[model samples]
Target: MKLKFTLLTLFLVLISALSFAQKSNNSQSIISGKVNISKYHSREELKNLDKGELLTLYIERIEVIVNILPNIAFATKPGVTMASLGIPETKDNKKALEENKEASDTYFDSTIEFQKSILPYSDKKDLIAAILFYESTLKALHTYEDFKKD
Candidate 1:
């Protein structure tokens, strides 16, 4: 009986130590900061992007910007258009502009779904930044390139 008690005590100590170590590691973990848009907008790399690639990069930039910003009030209904944080929009031609807007909206909705799906598993700081930056930059590059031609 004494031998069993000693073994049980040892096991409990080991479990306690492990639990404490896990908690400490969790406490030390840090989240990544938001991406800087001004830096990306000024980047020379953007000048070389073609229409399709520019669109993709623009969307990616938007995703990164969303991740870094405060949680926004999105619509509860699917397919509903929500306000952009603060970016201004100009419609050069109504029909063409609306079509472009619709495509952009669809992309944003898809991004929200994608973010929700993978965010649960990611913990690395750079991985999170990559996800946000790639998505946002893709979208931004697309829209800006289109607008520039107007």
Candidate 2:
């Protein structure tokens, strides 16, 4: 009788664990679907915008990207460290990593400033090109980040 009870208990625990795993997977899929929907809506909104409006939106989006640069830089840093307790030396290539980060910051800042300056004078084609450039950059960065997570 005790052996049968132990087997039944083990089976129940295994079933519950499997159910929990399935729920976790379902939640992840839901989140991924939401991201896709959001991207689709953004593209639709951009497509419907007039030239002047699109330029304005482009400038605003560039500003937002600039604001998030620090976070992106932090996340993509080559070295790993926990500085709170004063423990360092977690990773190597510090010099090269800092140089690459500085270069990226300079490039992004310059591109943003150039886009802002020329926005008022830009036509539909110019605006569309700028939009595509920024959008693709953002998409690439997001994909890279996701890849890093996995």
Best by TM-score: 2
lDDT of 2 by residue, 4-64 (tens): 9999999999999999996553111101000111231255566778877786667655654
Candidate 2 residue runs with Cα over 4 Å from true position: 1-48, 76-118, 146-150
Report the lDDT tens digits of candidate 1 across residue range 1-150. 999999999999999999999655321101122344443432345544444444444545664454433222322112323123232233333344355445545666788577556544544443445544565544453354355464
Q: TM-scores, in order shown?
A: 0.34, 0.40
Q: For model 2, state the Cα shift of residue 78 in Å.
A: 18
lDDT of each: 0.46, 0.55
Q: How many angstroms is residue 12 displaced in model 1 relative to the true structure, after the best TM-score fit? A: 3.4
Model 1 ranges with Cα > 4 A deviation: 28-48, 71-109, 112-150
Model 2 residue 59 CA deviation in Å: 0.6
If candidate 2 were superposed on the true structure by all CA atoms, what would the RMSD be?
13.4
